[model samples]
Target: MADTFHDTDALVAALSDADLDRPPALVANAHITGVSVARALSAHDVPVIALDRTDSGVAPPSDAVDYAGQVTYPLDDADGFRADVERIAGALAFEPVAFACMDEWVRGFAETEPAGVRLPFSDLAGVERVLDKANLYALCEELGVPYPETYEVGETDADEIVERLAFPFVVKPAHKRKFEEAFGTNVIEVEDRGEFEDVVAEAEEYGATVLAQERVNVAVGADTSLASYVPPESADRDPLAVVGNAAVRYPEFGSSCLVERVEEPAVREHALTVLEETGYHGISESEFVYDADREEYVLLDVNTRPWKWISMPVAAGANLPMAAYADAVAEEEYEAEAATDGPRDGRWVYLPDYVRRCLTDEAFWDVLSEDDWRSLFSGEFEREGELTTGLYRPSDPAPAVRYLTGEFTDREYYCSC
Candidate 1:
């Protein structure tokens, strides 16, 4: 990794000076997923420029990153973010493919449609249409996909909302990126009518549209995500897809700390249907939560980026970042090979979090299955390859060491799922 550039101008100058044969891929948000993106593309012999807004995360020390820089504006600032993208792109001789690793970056990139950069996903309008959860839920309903029963706080009356949904409902933003920026958390669970009303007031104050959604019990079942990619030209073709489930997610309602690749054909089928229906063209993860009561999987948010456990698919022999890159740069439209889940499914564990949980949570082992323990002990998961786990790689050990000893020790460790 190069010395971090504090501003876009210096970063662009450095990028121009290094003028290589091929255009470098730009990875936004140099966190865990960004590091994985750099590794995936660099392994394919593509040059990479990794960018981030904050210096707190693990990507700064990763060997996989060729160029590391800091952007002045936060991802929510569309104008500032767009200006920075243009600055970086204008300096490079060849057109760079821009990859947004987090939701806010996805929103910024999708909305801006930077002049000189090539986006891995669809055009601005198509990308924006799918990113908003409100539109996603409506599309799910049109396609007969199962999602949690939800009422928009702004559109529906407060009394009607409480009457329609059960107690212990969730209050969340229809547009997640903005809400996360405002509140620093994704979803707020409200236990009673007073709490729900208070949350609605809070959301209104921040100019965010909150939704009252029926709470699905994740304690009984797993959180599943259909990580997939659909080519730009061939929307009709079946997506490169893999199903992964969170065996353990800390905070109960928060992000998955440990995910295992599993065979969920139903998840694949549903995700494919959603992708095809939307005419979505790019890498995406369709998240689902198992509703034990309904004995069905309920559709949640659809992330239009490289997700946290993206390396799991790459390690399982389906490299989405490579596929997206090839499609963007190739003369002809790139067709991805058939997606494989490997002989044994892969595991993606955030080692620091997993280790911390073992020390702190006594019931952690009780939740995981015998097969999960066996696979971990036998090293079957590690056999798939280097990018399978987050932060730790024998080939590139510094990031893990820094993360474990520095960020995690200070309790400042944060990864946007």
Candidate 2:
């Protein structure tokens, strides 16, 4: 039974009930990403329980997800979150497989591996190393992976940075979440020396350690993401990889709004290398921008959890969340379906953001190739293997309705974390 519980006593009672057949999948937040994970696992007949900080009336109620209402916020109160997690875990009939969708949730679960649950991400230290861009860049350098050329803000002099690098570089935080907290966006594009210095000073005023990175002239239609799952070491199985090309993004260099499932071997290779180097075992999405000048793909960022377009992989015949869950539960070797000639040639669209960008941004039109433009107004939504939306599914229609009614109208639905 997928029951919503407002009190711990009721929640514990429901979970502890012996009649509950299978061990439920505990999802951290009920945001779009978490909802997608829940749906992915439910397709395999796994029960899903979504634990959020509060109901808040924002997240759409889904048949695929049962709410664990008003839990302690993982980022705000780590101790309380740990206690709550343990309390919930102790009531379960079997060890629940936990999936954390946000950075804070990942950190919370990693730091406190509460009893009676299976975590899918790396440990605290390993996850932190990847979350911090400075540390990630260092690791990329050590492993000979190509990332954007970067200059440290505090350590390097402002004048020297301007002198060394060309104009129109970017200023971003070493720690992305901290900066995003201070400012709404993660990056600031500096057009010249003056703007570069100004942005750096502004970031310092907010006590954020920023970095200067060369603006990679990304090739059109070359922004790619590799969604993968690395099983635990005991499973000893090959990782499952699915490559997605971001045809368009919103808010100028933000998350993918429209993606095309494609095969890019080099992008997959670089991402797997990093995951192997760190011993990261879980669902991950590694982003890359193709540098046409260098004829290479430059690694941009890595997400250790289910990404914004995670549902795309399930549509493409590679279910990452299910693969992780199976490996975590079974002792036998798990051989995932190879990334192959399935329904991989399709488009995944975050409908709200894609439509918003298309209507508002003039530059959004310039990014679209001839075929992309044709497909934009094609008005074909029902064709199988043609398109998969981020939220809308025939069987699960409430979430999409909620999104379009409330969040989409208010313009506060940028949950691309």
Candidate 3:
């Protein structure tokens, strides 16, 4: 039978009741999601066994924990992955719960592990559809959901691309972190044909095709998101859980800045419709741009994994990690409910960069109306804590410090920005 915990204290109490002789295995240990979940588990005195590609230098604060390093990759080599799973599983005495944080790692374990290790993903084909942007956009188009206009430029001439996509567009790699060293920007805006050609030329060094897309200027007003977890069987009904719902604001009309949370039912309905039509199960976040000209919201992009601001929703009550764990273990029939009742306005400001942008950028004033300016300065708005800040408490700063000081060599195990 599965152990149940009603609240944080009850969860901790249940952890205190666990048999430390056999601890749960946290796969992809170096990942922030793994680290956050491990820390939360540790608070409950649950024994944790961390398994990843590297040692990550820092160990769990709890003495009841152990670390095992294993090199595993997702590829066509089924034998190699199965062997690694066997080794890791044997090392932990065949731990029942294996928390998967990385996509490739998750797929590998899901494909190779025995039935005892529970994974919260659909079949391999389902994973592929969600991970690939091209596939996702194609699915969205078929479902009559709105998506940014995208054109792939593999080896085509620059003039041809410009002719097709026109100037004042965006050129981004299919995945943001593929060319981090070369481009230094996730999404690049091209004002004219000259800038577009220059950016495309630079993108070629990364061995990726440049995707020119229409620039949706939703950053001018507010960029909001609706995140949820759906089940494979119930795509037609409500989601299994609503994990996150928040809005963000930029300092300038054109600058990329911090985000916040604001409640809007219209935004939620649009996001939910897209998720359902796409058959997107697991954690999905849909971004929307409020266009003032049309007085409507336009879909920007869809993230198939946990978001950077995951902690905000946890503070607001929908703990995605816990919900995902529950769903993975089949402890309860998943149910979705609106977490945020009314329109609660809040903002998460990136203090250092937000200050700098406001001082230097003239377009900053275009983003905020007179009322927003008054509310911001008056401190009437609620501010969510930074996601990266409180992962390690003062009592335990080893993990956070190690992560910052380059002590961890397993960078791939963690989510790449």
| Candidate 2 clash pair list | none
Tens digits of lDDT, candidate 1, 309-389: 887877766778888887888664544434443424667777666666667777666444566556555655454432267
The candidate with the higher TM-score, 1 or 2, is: 1
How accurate locally is residue 38 in candidate 2, as Cα lDDT from 0 to 100? Answer: 81
Q: Worst lDDT window (10 residues) for model 1?
A: 334-343
Q: What value does the lDDT take at residue 70 in candidate 3?
A: 44
Q: Compared with the true structure, what per-residue lDDT tens digits does model 2 show for residues 1-417?
A: 244546655677666763546667888777788778888887777778777775532332777775455568777888888888888889877788889888778877988878778886678887877777888888899999999989898788888888887988988998776677767788888898778877877777788889999999899767998998888788787887789998888865667888888888889889899888887788888989999889999998888898778878877878899898887777434334344665456677887787788899876564445554455445334345456777766566767766667754655543544
Candidate 3 colliding pairs, count: 4
Q: How many times do residue backbones clash in model 1? A: 0
**Colliding residue pairs in candidate 3:** 247-260, 247-261, 248-259, 248-260
Instruction: Please give the lDDT score for candidate 1.
Output: 0.76
| lDDT of every predicted structure (CA atoms) | 0.76, 0.76, 0.53
